[model samples]
Target: MKCKDCQFCKYEGAGIAGGYKCKHPNIEESAKKYEQLKRKVINKDYPHIGYQMIKTSLRYCPYRIDREESL
Candidate 1:
């Protein structure tokens, strides 16, 4: 009875290397593939939708892009 697969690994392994440990080769490849995907911006073209809209979108997004709050 040996632990061949690391618990963190997505796949189950049956080899014994200190009781189920994650193999770096496969994990590294999988991680690299995951990182290859391009991140998509939620709003690419629109400058500012609205206060409520931006709030609905997310809190991190700046609420003042082209505003002149002097009045």
Candidate 2:
């Protein structure tokens, strides 16, 4: 199932730059880490560190809940 069809999917930003992210409580810790990494990349604080992207398995996610089912 796609993230856009999941109840926990949250959209951040607006327009073409907007993206979907899972907001499930179980993944909160990893989400925090992702944010920290994103900030580091944007600020260029760690020259040795390369840009890291958050990888979420939306296709077969165990935590995924159908939006229609939730409603």
Candidate 3:
């Protein structure tokens, strides 16, 4: 997938193939948080709440896959 699809990536140009930067300062922290939130969804622990939280958290995750790619 292209870097533009990554949550941590910041696109500088006008298109998807443009230059970008990984905005996550702490990769480990970002990953940990992502995983924890993901588990909540998997375990069905307040799925509604977890889904909302995960939606926001995923946008800042360093390891998040491109939504386009996943489909």
Candidate 4:
């Protein structure tokens, strides 16, 4: 299922800057890596490659909990 349909997905921030983030405890490592890659892109450390890598790294969550089931 898509992350947007998962129970662990949480929306943070506000307005246009707001987005859904995975809150699954098991996603900590992946989240950290994502943050690091995000920083690199923001800091222009690996601008081109970072963006591509980030795109590839984003996949359907393995630990996703279906919202319907949880409810």
TM-score, cand. 1 vs. native: 0.22
TM-score of each: 0.22, 0.32, 0.26, 0.38
lDDT value for candidate 4?
0.42
- Checking candidate 3 for backbone clashes, the offending pairs are none
Task: Give the best candidate by TM-score.
Answer: 4
lDDT per residue, candidate 3, 1-71, as tens digits?
A: 23434455454444543344456566446445656665632332111122112223333244443342366
lDDT of 1 at 8: 30
Give the least accurate 10-residue stretch of model 2, judged by summed lDDT.
Answer: 44-53
RMSD of each: 20.9, 11.3, 13.8, 10.4
- lDDT by residue for model 1 over 4-64, one digit each (tens)? 2223323333443222223333433333333343343334212222322121321121221
Candidate 4 Cα outliers beyond 4 Å, as residue runs: 15-17, 30-57, 64-71
Candidate 4 per-residue lDDT, tens place, 1-71, comes to 54545566566656555555556665655444545645532332211121111323233233422232256
Instruction: Output the TM-score of candidate 2.
Output: 0.32
Model 2: per-residue Cα lDDT over 1-71, one tens digit each: 44445576665655544555456655544434544645532332211111222344432233432332356
In candidate 3, position 60 carries an lDDT of: 27
Candidate 1 residue-wise lDDT at 3? 18
Candidate 3's displacement at residue 28, Å, is: 1.0
